[model samples]
Target: MFPTLHIAEKTTGSRGSLALLRWALVVIFLWFGCMKFTSYEAMGIAPLMQNSPIMSWIPAVFGVQGASYFIGTAELVTAAALIIGTFNKMASAFGATMSCLVYAVTLTFFLSTPGVAEPTAGGFPAISAGTGQFLLKDLVLLAASACLLLASIRPADA
Candidate 1:
């Protein structure tokens, strides 16, 4: 479990940790987005994209490979915005919104992607250890993105 945050303390550790989280998200987005430029990444996501009603138009508009590039570009740009947000409030707001959008969109794949859930001895909502785990992990990213968004959108103290 993570340590409890004391907002009133305004400790160096707290601010540093928050900053580090932002940097980590930026790096992860950049790395994953870069992978989309490759054939393997494109192919790997083909089924998920095809199955997703929201994303079905991607292949028609950008083609399978091109869609990957488009997503990759989005990722890189979002990462850049987050990096800029480190210094500017407007930039942080933009980056935070973008990051949150990305997380929300991807999280929807829980509905579109098959094998995400499997029949288990327990019940109807059992999650697959593989694909299910992968999609569920995005919750943390969503929370982190939300944190950034809240920090950026709130009015500065007088």
Candidate 2:
């Protein structure tokens, strides 16, 4: 029904868009993963990790800074697999799976961490700009990662 839709689609077809999505995810993982090594970033995430039932064990076992390092290492590995995925579908599937898991865990911060709702704004659906909004973005990332995983598993002709 839209006149320019075909032109826009042709400009960046499905494959092209998928490639862009893949690269964008790569950048996010690489950048944030690297940032995990810094004391500032480590401390910034500590409260979230501390409150999470799923993540609290990390700090207990490795200590705060050590837990950050461990997470950073995992992210770098995911990035490497994604880079290699450009050449290998199996690698792509693996990387996408990792991406899904990472984002899923991050999304849980919305439930576990305090102050997700801005109490002054009447709370509940009224999300806080800081932690709540920051974490909400992972919903998109998880969906994107799922798409990549499905594409990796699909037949070549499909």
Writing each residue's lDDT as its tens digit, candidate 1 over 60-82 gives 79999999999899999999999
Taking every candidate in turn, the Cα RMSD to the unseen true structure, in Å, is 4.3, 3.1
lDDT of 2: 0.91
| Per-structure clash totals for the candidates | 0, 0
CA-lDDT, candidates in order: 0.86, 0.91
Q: Can you write out model 2's per-residue Cα lDDT over 41-154, one digit (the tens) per residue? A: 899989999999999999999989999999999999999999999999999999999999999999999999998998999998999999889999899999889888888888
Name the runs in model 1 displaced over 4 angstroms.
1-13, 120-124
